[model samples]
Target: MPGYGYVSEEQRGVVLLSDDAVIPQVINDRLVTAFASVTITNANVTGQEILPIHTADSQGPRGDESGWIQVVSARATCSEGIQIKIVLPVHFSIKLAPGQTYPVPLNLSIEGDNAPKSMRIHLDLADLGNTKRWTVSTGEYELERREWGSAYKITFLDYDHSVHYAMAFPPEGNCEQWPEKRCPVVLALHGAGVEASSSYWTESYRRQKNAWVLFPTGRTPWGYDWHGPSFWNIESALDALRLRPGVPDDLVNSVGVNRERLIYAGHSNGGQGAWWLLSHYPDRALAGLPAAGYVKIQFYIPYFMRIGDAYADPLLRGILESAISEHDIDLYASNMAGIPILARTGGSDDNVPPVHSRRLIRMVNEWSRKTTAANLSEIPNQGHWFAGVVDDDVMQSFVDTSLQNASTQGLSLPALPSAFSLSTLNPASSGSKGGIRILQLQVPFRLGTIRVHRQNDQWILNTTNVRRFGFVADDRQEGLQRWSVDGTNFDKPPVVSGKSYLKGEDGIWKVADDMLWISEERHFSTYGPAIHIFDQPFIIVIPSTITERTITYRKMAQHLATSWYLFGRGGTQIVRDVDVLDGIAAQYNMLVLGGPEDNMFTKKRQPGLESMVKFLPGGGFQIDKRVYVDQGTGILFLAPSPTRTRMGLFIAGTDADGLLRAAWTVPFRTGLQVPDYIVLGEEYGDPSTGWTAGDGAPFGGAGTKGAGGVLAAGYWSNHWDFDARCGYLK
Candidate 1:
């Protein structure tokens, strides 16, 4: 729109190639005009409006093909280092009023076969819809076949009860049967909201691997219509699985059960339920692998609003438990007994953080004092999903060890960098400060949160309190030590940030440069459990690049500080972006989107709406609710808004406190995962709200905090819009 005046902003359509260098596919969308700009106080040129364009989501699954999303937008630059690229499907329009919405469409792609958490599209935006932040996988890919069933029902033959949508999977290659007996029955239980019968678990594909997997959906509530029981229907499901025509009566007693022996595993939602199966009925499962929910999910249930209310049903829980305790977490402790186990999780995972698995390992080691029969390992470079499932060698080890280890391997944590390790534990003094058991992280990493309590006589930081640990360092750092509380340099060591290369890349590369807060120019010993702390800054080192053809790059390092958030530039009136705020408030919790609607906070129109709301606070994502301040029962917190929009009548609500351990997204490894410079922010924290009675909404003034700043305004798909930026903060 180079002042090529004449064309009034109107509904239109055009198709062109994408901006990212990786995937260049053509996209179609309408053209629109945007008036956006940054104003400075005491300047003669303060009152000016630049371009403001917006977009909308396409129909069903349009603009998706061959690992790339069809996104084409009109881009402009109002300031240097700050450019906007917008790609609108149908939701994007050229006709927008003072308070109309331009829907944001984000389609992320995943590379070839990786784990659940491995390389997927991610919208890295604060006000999620303001930008187009998603994965753009452009890696070496191989055709992968993932056929699984859904909506399976398990019947408890003895009791004549039935669990619908039970799940199972056979080997992908073959389902060759054994000479005698039946396939080992993997009594796989689905997590809350997940009907055990769906192909999400692919029990059929798993069955092809070796064992006969069986999924038993939980029972529906006695009186409630859509409601379901809160625990796993193990007994009933097992009875039903055994009753199958081709299956055997007793699975374990028979060797070479089915095709392969019965091995047990489940991801996030399912992972939580797996604990209950192992706990209440350990004998049924020979081996159990609970990903991220073996401990924390159970511990934080009561505090979680979604599950907290459900605890009222005595039959649904143990007296008073989070109604949704991942269904199986309750019986997890019992499963630790004699059960050969392998637990895996991500260190950077905020939802059902790694602390859950870490705690399980801690409890077992303290009691049995050995990891012989069981072991818990973590993938610090990952988050909630099972990223690089088969690649990281974590799952591969799990498949190998869970089948072999008859005893524990003495659960041992890998040595992390000092940046993540807690150096001291000076507890609140009612008594006095104790000796410091320095949580010495090896090097080149950071820990999530560290809690120092008395581990026997010495002060120690264990996984129970430490929540999670993110591995930032490679295989070169030192370990932890027992330091005195009064020692100097109380902070953990630093981490450098610069471009660095790992297994692949054009010669030397780095994670981040300038973002560093600490330097790795110095050397430190490496060991297990790299310390990760908040507010404590550190650097992320990168692979240094030299000559063009040089593949061997030296390590480059810089530093970055842990971040906190704040916003208060305007009122809450900006909730009208039906495409953005509405969905975000309903799905995320850290921040509340205040507007003139109730449906955003309810589940009438959307089926999984409640599910999103249910899990966000504690389920995993930590998303909260959207409501007016007039509604009571919610707590409140505030943040600073870059956009100085008049604070509309938006009230923050207190969904669940401390329910969100944390939320974050690792920068994409290759430019393939997501477009670079996308506006990314992990909305974490309990949804808290308050009444907004300010005068006119905080106007996006001639201040540094502009109205556009209030909204998550950024270069969407490498483009931007500058409409009357309003109501973004609360």
Candidate 2:
């Protein structure tokens, strides 16, 4: 009988069974167990996979030293005339010093439920010349020591995905006593391609002595440098840590954080994320350190050759540029004025040019008009990875300074800073900073800033793109006796009610409700007027009943669900319309697929959807006074949820074909051109161009009445109401 052995090409380790080995076969329902012992020595590792062995690409084994190796055992049962395959996982941790070679030894043994099997193999390190220094294995491995930290996984109610994070606690003496003690937190984001699930990455931060180091997976190996959904993943990770039994109750509380001493730091791609989070969420961190980071994706990788840029259409360019502007850190650089930042890059690094960091520092200084620019350090003659960036004296000093400030200030919220500014894209729940609250956002996804400066005895409020905002006054402080709105002086005091206030109509005070204020808990929808849906979890509802033709809708729903999963890294759930429970609408944003007749949820909610678009009986859709009955026509729009104020996206058509065509357009094209609502027309040949094309090909054109092309297209107002003036209907 032939014996089987386990071998790893990447780890350069193998477990071989001798030719004379005898293995046991299970008899009728009997239990069995197997065991193996293996030892390995220096091996000749000459492959690419052996060099960068771990996911983090930082630590591995060396040929000169004895590599750490361990074996896992397993067993399987087999019935008469049946064969089974059993697999076991092996772990290896190796780190070799530079330019060393040594002969390796191997010992092997096997026992239990099988005949004795033994094999020996030696690895030669001579083949790898002085040029190669180290060789390690690919895949996860258990750490030899437990001093680094512990790994954990958590799931949040608002997110469809589970998050993975690593936490490293401070040394015993470093930890403060309970009740009166609060340790500073360092949120260290990993670079692109580094898996936080592995102990290798978390172990690197163990050198930081006095702080609780948090390493979040950023939702995936690659997550847009922690933008959009990735940012939320970090927040959810923090929430999970607070509830963990291992964490002290006072260290991480109900709000999920020790907000005062929070510090953000990152390297490479994570470096970019540190900057992004710092600018967009200034209140979340005390100071930020970004190393070898880029300013924006466009700057890092120019988009001049993209399809949108190739067209060179002013309209198309405007739409594309406006959409991504919210993520451009330079545009929001001024918001970093009040916070401390230390940015660094290696002068010899070619991966990410050092100029990006220099330019950002200059922009922040110019925009804020502050004498002190962001501190920039360029290490000379160093490459992308430099020593002391994470645990250097300079970094330690910065953290110490920030922690001292927090300790002096205690836990109370700081008073509103003089000459401070607040900016946000989604005012509904952006968050409060320095006692100011943004109540409404006139232009969502566009920057809205409120600047306040106390001059002499009056408080002056300077606003841009702001619809409504308020301040929670500290009645104990008596500085400003009057107020000025946009250069207009008002003798009346601002309205105040229950810790919040709204700017009064006549410059007087009016009671304000917390519901109207923007909060960190704000939810977003996918359809128009609420384009930033990444912050909230969403579900897709397919028709419960299916026909031969309606089966295509299932495929369409899959495409959408997959796109969202890839984009957000697992925040999408799919369910049949019948299985969608009553309160689900309130819990998640709904994407209802299929026509009214085919989908139970759509059919039941049709009456409530009439205000937006009505699916008339017999085969057409009615919008206002016009009726669309084209065979290939499809309707995609957003409406208020029947059960709640949240939004629902509806993709319905006259039939299956229309629905498929519309669904395909969304995953491929739909952008600013498709706007809040769109009606796709039949596939036809364009006589003028002699081309067979769909009316919505490329991107759906503006809709018009009596036209076989795009039937209609328009945007909804901020209030989620129809905008007749902005829509097209021939």
Candidate 3:
């Protein structure tokens, strides 16, 4: 009724029951049909009313557009285990572009007889776009679109609580129906702007006889370029198959994905993501195939265009760039020494030239003790895309061999080499090798390395810039293991619970009595650069009382929610202080908006933060002895969660105007770092604002286009304390 009209004969703007419906002019004679369907399975004890919701995109209508899309809604009924389709709610309008996605309510009342418990039903309709963006297909195999709710809120373009992933069943058969044995899975990542539904993404791959390929939407077509939230999406999708978190147990009962035989493969941006994930999560995959992958951001496109770096302080730049150092895939290449890799590229291509794969191959060879672990395949006289990029004889052979090897190894880690090296910049993102993990680094954002070798019946270990490390002994290995770490000798018995941890103190390594899991010091999950707060499920906590100040705070929260949807395909949950209980506060890392006076949550926690940051009674705040009473000054910082092991990101200002200025510093993209904390002033302009390409630069350069700049910024100490050396004051 909202977007359509009927021929008017008896009245000017009234339609009779016998009149035919007319389509809108904009859509204009397109072959339209209901192309998308969302199946809703009732798993409850009794039939209840269900209101299905749809997610709206952030790219709202433009110009004179009404900013709403018309969609037809229907009800799904089940009669004695048989599904019956019924059309209802002829047409309705839902808002699309609101910076962030909100649930568009659909009317459908289910009765017990029609929708009994354990019944499966679906609502189908034609979307604004006719194509199903999340569907994947391979002519030879059966591919289906599956959705599962994320453990954390994504706050992406759609209010739909579910994240969609494309699954291509093995050539043998659909694993869901006949999963007598586990099938190896290839986690394929799509390039930037490449739709998950595209046949080119999967059809070009040489399919294994019994392997399945998984394609994640990465939240959106270009979501995070398979980093940050995009990376987490892959994890969630895999978990859904294995019946882990964020999925229903009945979704996939049989063991489908072979946990030990997983492979990572991609092309273009996905190729780069494959390399990143392989290095960061080496233990997850048996092999990697990255075609047309480029090197890190700085190497991909040199920062010769960055205007600010010429005169900026070296310390500031280092702190800022530290946030993105993980993007440099080469830095963590050593972690993949034991894993096999097949790197490919087009020799004649200009986009992501051949040198990238060549360099990556060379680096892996240089770091690997087994020189044959990595190989390069260069296609001559070809550009970026070619038929045999990943479907050729060599590629097929590699896949077959990798799967064969995985079958022999089962799900256990391949026999570890007596001597090997583990390199990392961020311990949180990087994976462990051979039961050895780097828990904490002496200096954050700096290269940390550990080299281990066995000599003369004793295990010798050397570490660089490592503060704490641990080793979990394997049950297969017997007897007491003698260790010499940095010349400090110790004997550890490889018992049932053989976990040994050590910490470096004043150049000497000592057995640390404190458990690594409960350590208060900045560890893997708690590290930060402001942007890391979104890596987990976080809540936006705003002031409960309605006021001019609270309204401004709410606006800031809305901006953040929208930004996440646009850049990271993330979902955010915004709540008032009064609605957040103690259990909720302890469970989630909060993004607390407004100062103590306006936000009750902040007021209750201010005393604990007084030593480092204290909000004044009337207006303004103080950081260590420096006082800022200006209405144009804003403060942003990450503090340890007062109630739990999580982190809390505080965004507050002297007043509403300052809060707006501070919101600019919260990064939604790859580049533009705002370390642990920063003080912003509306003077020189907002630091690094504008389009942030996946490359480390903003719009091809260090952007400074918004209305303010960083007044003071720095990292928190290893223990989350204010350290003078890590801070910068104006």
Candidate 4:
């Protein structure tokens, strides 16, 4: 009773610590503010005290935390930095030393003669009767909004679809000196739950001299976790800011966002998003600052949470999880070996532990040991959220250093390491490093490493799990010389510009011709589980003619659309088959909801897709001479688009019920894997109640073909053909 207080029947809480402190007398100044450090004793008696200053999810409290406490105070109204925006809370179990006092830094502000002279403050630690209030008096650092730059909105069409983002010019005002003089740009990404509509992103960052800040909503707060479509968001925003099609030339030139001097900075999930771009598109950023970022899905949670994994076969599980494995940040660290990275984290942060930052920095240094491109900044006595985390002097120095490195004319791409290895899991999402790139892998869902060493007379290269690799011809003092790859020697290889070489099925490396390079392979860009289709702009094609199953088709389409918005923040366009024709829709990936008989688009492409699987007149489909006529069977697979270049996803079933079951496999988030082809049955039971699939067991399964309710599941071969070794059929 003494420790806790009751605000209401449902709101029972406790104020761990409270104290009254006098502010510096507003002597001869109109406004005053100071940094006060209050030392408090850890008197929890039970264990270490937790200061949960912020929550990651926009939804609700996770784990053991609860809603924010309703306290009437001016301190609560202040959203000065990332630290005090009170939302859902998560208690990080970080243990501080026993019987020790900790310093809790507080920023106090006062204005005008009428402002409150002194105020009381509360914290998580126990109250100390005798304590000194350490204060550092200084001028009021807060400035007028105009000095911080003006935040404005800009819209652009991404592949004919409308998209908008927030942009701000520097304190020097708009780039009035466009082509004559340009300014740098900072692409600031917001954390999870921080809506793009808020002014926080634009105003939160410290204004850089002659630099513009662009904030793309990333569709929604959690769009692709800032991966897939988020890339397009940033590019479109930059394009609109620098040069737009319809906008007046004066406004366009007013903000010259230099492409060569681009910098990326974010916090929390956004911090992870920064890492994603830093690793995947290293050439795009001059430098990156990721504060409180997590490593990857598996590292975030050791035990898999997907119910399917408990019931999936070992091989099937591998195929499914491989789809997620592409997003693993650690595997792609080699690409960031050349970029300057300053990773920041709270020294005592347990929410997204500091280890994530440490692990990534370690990997980056290991790949670029000579340069040591990445460094870590761990602020002591801080949690997940802290004031001045991204705007600190050290961070400003890193960014300023990167800006100084930019050239006037064009981008200054990092020089290729004389001898460095390039590692990649998905070549499509990964950019070229050290002038070397992997076009495709010998096997899908496996790590591919290409090691290069510069010897005296020639360059040596070795590859593991690599099918094809490419290199650019560059001018050096020694000029083009001999080359050796996988023990095959070549004297003056015929690569005037650049060339790609592939290892044929015979295990011999040969120069890849224009027609045989990356065209006919199941690259990660073209072939993947259910989630891969949303990597780009996709249209949902539903049936034109109305029938008893028409509502079901529409409902399924709507469900897919809503899921994308909720999970990936995707703006998926849904169109009726009759309204849009093949010629116009061919440019976009099509997500056909119903079977060929009901959906005209599917019917038109049935013959083309027959090479792998054939859809029958009714709901039954044929795979490799086997016909599954089960009324409850649902089939979801990937097929070549009408253009024979893009991808088309088919989510169909033998009947209405089966269609609903198939939609269950659409992975909106991580931890769930769906192979290139997956068959769902009624064995999953009703979704409203819960999952009863695999007889309600989630540990281990029998086999791929008949395990759980999965009738069949497997990945397509490099040529997009049925591979006996990679697939299972009933």
lDDT of 3 at 481: 66
All candidates: TM-score: 0.30, 0.65, 0.74, 0.71
What overall lDDT goes with each candidate model? Answer: 0.28, 0.53, 0.60, 0.61
lDDT of 1 by residue, 485-527 (tens): 2121223332323322121123221223241211221111111
Which wins on lDDT, candidate 1 or candidate 4?
4
- Lowest lDDT 10-mer window, candidate 2? 48-57
Please estimate how well model 2 matches the true structure, expressed as its whole-model Cα lDDT.
0.53
Against the true structure, candidate 1 has what lDDT? 0.28
Q: State which candidate, 1 or 2, has the greater TM-score.
A: 2
Q: Give one digit per residue, the lDDT tens place, for model 4 in 1-730.
A: 1333223222122212223121222222322223333233322233222212222111222222211221111232223332222111112111112222222334444443333323344433211111111112222322211212355444344432423344444434554433445666787788877865466565667777657766777755666677666666776667656652222334445555575456878888888888988877665667899999889867777746555456656776666567677778888887787678899999999888999999999999888875466899999989988877777889888876776565442335545556777777777677655556777877765788888777765778899999887765332214537888898777884353446788877877888656443455665467576566766667777776667776577557656765664565344545566544555455667778888888877887788778678888767998777787787678888886755456777888888877877776666675565777877766654432224433332433432222356777766767776776667674
- The TM-score, computed over Cα atoms with residue i paired to residue i, of candidate 4 is 0.71
Model 1 regions lying over 4 Å from their true place: 1-163, 171-180, 203-208, 220-232, 245-262, 294-298, 302-335, 387-393, 400-730
Q: Regarding TM-score, does 3 or 4 come out ahead?
A: 3
Q: What is the alpha-carbon lDDT for the whole of candidate 3?
A: 0.60
When sorted by lDDT, best at the front, the candidate numbers are 4, 3, 2, 1
Q: Which sections of candidate 3 miss by over 4 Å?
A: 1-100, 103-161, 171-181, 243-255, 369-372, 411-418, 456-458, 472-480, 493-500, 504-519, 624-631, 684-708
lDDT at residue 20 of model 1 (Cα atoms): 15
